[model samples]
Structure formats: C-alpha cells, structure tokens
Target: MTLKSFSGVALAALAVTFLSAASAQANDISKCVLSGEKGSVAITPVNEGAITVETALPNPAWWNGDTPDQIADGYEYCLAANIAHRAGFDKVNLVVSSFPALIANANQNKDLAMATISITDERKKVLSFSAPYFSSDIGVMVKAGTKVDAETVKTFRIGVLQGTTGAKFVSERIKPAEEKVYAENPAMFAALMAGQIDAAITDTAIILGQAAKSNGALTVAAQYQTGEFYGAIYPKESPNKEAMDKIIDDMRADGTLAKLASTYLADSWGADPTKVPYLKP
Candidate 1:
C-alpha cells in the first residue's frame, strides 16, 4: 500500500475509536442523572463509592434491625436500597443516626436520611426534604384496658419521641397534665408498658406496628388526622435534593414504591392504617 493511503486508514481508525468512547461516556452520564422540577441533576455519592443513607434503627417494620449492617430488611431499608440503585450507586452505606440528631444538625454529612421524618414548615428552616414518600397521622396507644380519647388524653401521662411531631402535638395542642419525651421508640414503649407513662402518641403506622407485635398487651386508642407526610431528608440547601425528589417521583409513578410498601409493610404493620378511626384533636 502507498504511504499516504496507510496514513489515511490509521487516522480513520483512531477517529472511530474516539467516537465510540465519547458515545459510551454520554450514555453513562445519562444513566447517572435524574430530571425533575429544577432540571437534570447528577447524583454524586457523599461517601467514596456507595451512597450514604442514615436511618434510625430498631424501628420494627420500618427499620427492623439494630445496627447499620444488620439493617438489611424492612420498608425503609428496601426503599433506601432502591434509591441508591436509581442514583447509579452499586451499593448503599447504611449508617445509624438518631432521628433528632439528623434534624438538629444541618451538616450531618450524609447524602440522605430516612427516619419517617414528617415534612413540616418549621423543619424546612434547617433541612431540605425530598418529595414525600409516605403519609401518616398522629396516633394514640394505651396499655390494654386503658381508656383515653382526645379530651381525656389531656389528663394522662403522655409519652412522646423527642424532636418529633408527636412531641410537638402534645406540647402545643394537647397540653397534657404530664408529658415525657423518650429518644427512641423502644424506650418510649417500655415506659408505657411499665406504667411509667399512661399512653404513647406517635405516627399511626409506628404505634400500630408496635401494638401488633405486642399481641394484645397494647392497643391503639385514637388517631388524629394530622395529614403528615414522610420524606427523605438532606442537608440544608443540598444540591442533590432535586435529583432525589425526581427519583422518588419516578418510583411513585412507576409503582415501585407501592410494590416496596406492599412487600415490607403489609406483614409488619399488621393492620391497615386507613381503617384506624380518626379523632378530632
């Protein structure tokens, strides 16, 4: 072959290789992005390779296990895993973080945290919330054979989880004769069963699940229509908020969220939250 022809063929091969690599890179970027209200945004992992997801643990049905690695089951775990996958991360780095700590500290450094956090205007001041993934209402649970209602609850010893809407409700609206704040669900439930607290108030799904596991030792007394929705929380003004919101919306639209709820929550919650009687609080 002539020297000129050989040079032309070599250059053509080099151009083809460059175009192929560029196309592959473009496809990869497309896979890494999520588009929503703001526009397309790329999800960058907060941790090295895996997406960091913080959750309050030992929450039966929602987060069944006690530690980070053991939290391989339940609704929130399943949802978190799905979120990581959609974000183009191969795995999720689950970390144990308290519910209050996550809310109070705006610079927690985690990519996302899910602790059944209710989206409230007051909380939005310090944190950015992804679009709501689940909704719940205020619930009242009492020891078996104990009687309590909206009005009567004002006189009972009430137990609430600190830094939660339940605590806010009891303090602001209920004005109960006595109120106790516990850091976590197990502690609060222990106080109720031991008679240290006359009743416990929190999200309907949570108390109902606890009550179901109690096997007649406890019962849900009343529920209020607070119309609260749970969202995945992000650090204040985090750039990834829009991307996570878009991912959640897509999951909802494609019925992925529904499937996860059905698989993990159906048996764990044990009772239908919608059927719980609503009381005026």
Candidate 2:
C-alpha cells in the first residue's frame, strides 16, 4: 500500500478506538444511574423499630389503607425509591427487618440502610450518613382530651418506634417507667388508640400526618425540639458513600430534594428547602 494511504488507515483506526473507549465510559455511568450496577442495596427498618422508610413504595397511587403493603407505599417508602432511582440505581430493594437488624446487616454486608434513621453523632461513629433527607422533631400524640402535660406524658406509657432515635431519646431523656416500643409507627399509634399505651412519641411529621388522617381521634400533646435529622445510613466503609453524598448534595442544590420533601411531607410539615435544618457534624 502507498505510505500515505497506510498512514490514513492507521489514523482512522486510532480514532475508532478512542471513540469506543469514550462510549464505554459513558455507558458505565448510565448503568450506574439506571441499575446501581455495583450491586443491590438493601434497606431495613431500625433495630426492632417499625418506622417506614422514604423508599418503601416506588409509586404513590396506593398509599391509603391499613395493610402493610399500603403503608409501605406511603410517604417514606416512596421517597426513598424516588431518590434511589434518581441516583442511578436500577432497582432499590427495601428489606423488612427490624432497625437493629438493618444496622447489623449494613455493618456486615455494607449495604445501604434507608429506613428513616436519624443522624446523630453517636451513630456517625459507627456508620456514614447521607445528607438530611428529612428534618423532624419529637412529638407526643395522645387520645383526644387526654389530660396530660408534656412533663406528665413522660411518666405514662410512651410508645416509640423500636430502635429509633425517639426511642433512644425516651430512654435517655425521659426514662419512662413503661415504654412500649413497636416495630412500626402505625402499631404504636394503634396501641395508643386501644389504650394499651398512654401516648405515642415519634417524628412530628409522621405523628401530624397520622393525626390529620385520624379525624380527631388523636391530638398532639406537645412537640419537643429534639432536632432529629433523618438520613440515609450506609456502612462505615462503603465505597459508594461519597457518591451517595454527592448525589444528595446535588439534589439539595438543584431543588430535587425540596420537591420530594414537599410531595411526601405535606405543606403543613413545611417542605421549604431553605427552612430545613442541617445536622451539625
């Protein structure tokens, strides 16, 4: 072949190889965005606790009703699924283990834990946390007309979601004589309605949502300034931890987080992104 023709052909081959490499890189990112191709992420409830996750349901059309599946489709589950999908995971799996089990599994397997875990300095020592997805304060829910002040409510049988910061707060701060920890918030609320528990302590947003749906059956006794910051928990040494943090930060900057919060937390919960408090490290 002529020397000029040979040179042209070699250049073309080089160009093709470069293009192929670029395309492959782009595909990897796309796969990460679509299927979280690294692996399947598992999120379980808090240790013995039953608070629903923001990612419980991939869709919100079926959030009413008293079934586990229905509750799963409610706000927390849906929110988690939405964020997972947006962050490039093909499918985010929600596991139904207790909160403690979830934490233990994450520690062992290094999977992401998405149950509504509140970020605390003590927990940060054990695991990594994503940016605050939701901000909540501790609140008390009692039967309508229950004559109890916030101080007296601490002495009564206080129901809490098992393995939650609320439960921990009650244990360390309130130290109630009889504390009932349920696997799920709905169960705790049910116990209050049944008179099995005097009052339920939980995130103000969840309790307010429950109260709004209950038609005056329950009332908020008092809302405390516990300053709870709910976050997506991950194993302490997760490789994807930085990536997940970047995605959450990007979402916050781009207003996606605010939009999701508004959809799930309701207007009354005050979904303003600017108003959301960040957890101090």
Candidate 3:
C-alpha cells in the first residue's frame, strides 16, 4: 500500500525499519576495512618487527613511569598496547619524546606518537592524525586557597606549556597580566608551586592529575569547554594512517576506550571533566 495511507501501527513499523537501515549504514565496515590481512596491516616498522610509539614522560594520569620500558600504567600506554596488537605487531617499542619535538619533526624518529596530542587544523599541516581517541577541555589551576574565577583569571600571571592549545587559549582569551611558557609540564607545575605564577592553564584531566598528586598544594580552580580532541600522530607520508584510523574508530565504537579510561584514569582524575564548572570565556 501507499505510505501516506498506512495506519499508525504500520507507520511505526516502517519508521523502525528505516532507523535500523540507517544504523547499519552508519556502522558499515567497508569504510574502514584494512588493506592487508585483517589484523596484520602492513606498516613500516621503526624497530624491526615492532611498532615504535613515542610519548612524553611524566604525563601523570595519561603516562606514568620515568622511562618507556618501566611504564607502570596509564590510559595512553594501554592504548599503545592495543594499537600494537590490532596491527599484528608482537612488540611495542615505547619511546620518550616531548610534544613539541614530536610535532616539529612529525614523528620522524618513530612509527607513531600518542602523546595526548590534540588534533588541530594547524597541526594537520605537518602531521597525519588518526581519528580522535580522547576529548579534553581547558583547565585553570592555582595553589590551594588562592581563589580565582573566569573574570579574575585574566588578571593572574599564567603559566602554560609551550606549543600547547592551552597556551594559545591563555594568550588569546585570558590575556592574563603576564604569561610564562615552559617547555614541559614539570617545569610549569614547579613554577606554580613556587609561586612564580598565579595560575596555570592546560587540559582539565592533566591539571586534575597534578592536583591529585599535589598533597593539598594545588587545586583545579576553573575550566573552560574548549572542545578539544586528542589524536595519534602518524608521519605525514605514512600509508598506514587509514588502517590505524580504522582501528581507533573501532576501539571507540566498542567499549574499549571506556574500559581503558576506567582502568587507568577513573580514580586519578576524580570527578568527570565535563562536570567540572565551566568558565564563560
């Protein structure tokens, strides 16, 4: 019969059928199918048979441990392991490198780098990034009991990591009285503890991790919803980007990403980042 002549129940059944078809279309695997074997997508190795994934050290909740070999536990580390398995690599050569250095060289020294590197239009020029794996918002931190809000944040002396979106936010939005840029997280947090800067701005999860380990010396005073997403960086010329993106998208579509976040970051990050109070900037 004609669709316009259908009864209410018939219309409902037709609607459900249409929705099911749409869902199936959205999850079509053909879009992300691997070019090589199902698991062993051919990838140029940085070290023999291993897929070398570089990440900066001392990244707290995202990457703990002093060295790559001794990596105890963290969300990003777990992600690296999963990537290796899906790519059919028996070994994962985890290496250390700063975010700025990796981005500058476009991971020339490794197969890929997952240093909680955010995906941005500007960075896409120098690096090929996989589908986003994590989302983050900008956060403002201060020594405990040192009060500051969205309005007052602009007046404080701010500390930021060089070449980070947080640093860019501080300069363009906060316009704080003074800005101190550090090449790394440790140095910037140290400056905050020493009273060198009145506030620090960066990813909410990062600041929260620092505050949790600070023993009452620091607190995440404010945050802004910058709607940032982190992506794994592949070399500009790498042919494996498509396959890697498929793998990451699969992980995200499944419950793998959520499980990893709970296993590595639930306790350390405390409250949900989105639930944190948002500052109107």
Residue 95 in model 1: shift from native, Å? 1.7
Give TM per candidate.
0.82, 0.65, 0.83
lDDT of each: 0.72, 0.54, 0.71
Among the numbered candidates, top TM-score falls to 3
Better of 1 and 3 by lDDT: 1
Give lDDT tens digits, candidate 2, residues 1-281: 33334222221122222112322122221122121222223333233212223232112221333433435333444444444554444343445555566655444442466655678888778767776655556777789898766457656998998777888888887777698888766678779999999989876656766766678888765766565566777655666666566655554444444444444445433222222232211
- How many backbone clashes are present in model 3? 0
Instruction: List candidate 1 stretches off by more than 4 Å.
Output: 1-41
Stretches of candidate 2 above 4 Å error? Answer: 1-82, 85-90, 106-111, 267-281
Which one is best on lDDT? 1
Per candidate, the number of residue pairs that clash is 0, 23, 0
On lDDT, who's better, 1 or 2? 1
lDDT of 1: 0.72
